[model samples]
Target chain A: MDLLPFFQQLEATTVGRVVRESLWMFPVIECVHLLALALLGGAVLLVDLRLLGFGLVNQPVDLLARKADPWLLAAWMVIIATGIPMFLSEATKCYYSPPFFYKIGLLVIASVYTFTYRRRVTRELAYGRAPLTACASLALWFGVGFAGRWIAFY
Target chain B: MNFSAFVQWLDATPGSVALRESMLGYPMIETMHVLTLCLFLGMIALVDLRLLGLGFQSIPVSEVAGRLLPIGLAGFVLMAVSGALLFYSGPIRAYGNIFFRIKMALIMLTGINALVFHYTIYKRVASWDRDPIPPLRARLAGLCSLVLWSAVVVCGRMQAYNWFEKAPGA
Candidate 1:
């Protein structure tokens, strides 16, 4: 079995070459990645904390969710854009790395959790039911963050 | 005079020696540090961006802040643990590193800024609660936060290049 196909594909791409070879590219892209992460982190903190009944006790849950949605979307967009290129530049390394794989998996789970939290959980909680999804949402995102950090090592 | 000596003594401690000698210790600690950083910064930015009107427009500032607190705190916890481990592994070197020093200073500033936001402006803002534009203080805090945190990240990245070098005079 050819284990290096992804690496071969990466080697063939001009952008991949630049990402790997350019002195400034990694730092610049990493900066963008961090910025995007900040945006995502901030937005999630607001909504998730509310679900846990910490902040904005007076405000309706749905209203809070609506307010924070845009920033989350923008942050995710930036993350995807910057993250994909970084991933592509070192596909082989990333693919073989367990932490990288876990990060990607957690990210997908987080995205799904975000949607579910909004649609099913937030709406139910707005009517005065206790938020059941808050704990899970928090855990998923934390996993994403933890796994993301581990990627550097793995 | 005493402070410098104390720093030197701490660096020479057995715990520090053990930390450096552990096989996977350094890499694991570094990885955890970066992860916590991402978590801490990520959560803060999400909340802050909301305050700045990036997302969740219909949500109350208080509500948004409330929801993100636990995860943020958890991130902080992880950071503290991992960060201490990092310092332990290279006490003398990190202590003398300019980038590391700067990063620590900025982290303190960020914490202070956060406390101020939570205690004062946040209360007032929540009362008004739906202002089209964030209050002057809130906006200022937000801007300061973004700059300080970004500075922390830059300093962190620069740490690898800023370790102590032998002085010619010494």
Candidate 2:
């Protein structure tokens, strides 16, 4: 099906025009997007690395997780808020891009993995045992990062 | 030495041709690069912020650094691999491209800065571990890290716009 026509029509609308004509908007939002990603990535890294017995070997894992959790959530909020508008600006291109599709898929999976498995991982870390869940979380987040990069190329 | 000639030579290499032809190669590499960049920047910020006495004030700086380092390394691996692929895809253009060169230089500087921080300041300041305020040297390193990484990101974003020019009738 010819999707360009639909996109063109959308681009003509007030909301669409804002998306299309807001040239200055995307770059500003992109800056924020990167900043937010840094926050989120940083928080996850701190907790995950501790789980692997890399750093903070003396501290309790649960405490580290609790300490970093708020920053992670806040960063996630910034990422989503800025990301949605950027997505809207080039909805058609992203919708049709395979890399973009994979990025979105990875994002969803990562989110689910974080929310469901994080608690269990924290428990294991607190007990001073090797946590498989933490490893898995790191792997999943790595996948998310990889897929996100793929999106730019596609 | 003429850097432009080196760039031209790199572009003309057979490997460049092979890189460009690989299916989904360029995009895949680019994607990985961005992903790693995110990781690198994110982890660095967290560590530096800790050094500056921001979040995780209760936790020992060494502990936070220890935990965050691996994640940063993982991200670094992704970036290095992906970045190499990107360079391979269009060696000449990327080599000649000012932004790409600047980004590369900054990345190297960032590495040096990191090593220096680890060797000189980290142990001395982190010996106190529980001191809410880190040593001045550590704080200086932290500020530098923040600035250098920000420059890396800006240079990376600028890469898309800086294309190499072709010689006429070559």
* TM-score winner: 2
Candidate 2 residue runs with Cα over 4 Å from true position? A1-16, A22-24, A120-125, B70-78, B108-123, B162-170
* Each prediction's DockQ against the real complex: 0.34, 0.50
Q: Write the per-residue lDDT of candidate 1 for residues A22-127, one digit (tens) a residue.
A: 7668767877787677667666665666676765666777766676677678878998998877877787777678988788899998898787645566755573
lDDT string for model 2 (B39-142, tens) is 77777788888888877889788776776777677777877777777887787767767888798899889889889988887757547677777888888888
- In order, the Cα lDDT scores of the candidates are 0.73, 0.74
lDDT of 1: 0.73
Q: Looking at candidate 2, what is the lDDT of residue A138?
A: 77
Compose the digit string of candidate 1's lDDT tens values, residues B1-170: 68667778877898888888876778778766775665677666656765666455566667656756666778889988988888877777887888888999999999899889878888787564676457778877777787898898877776765224566686
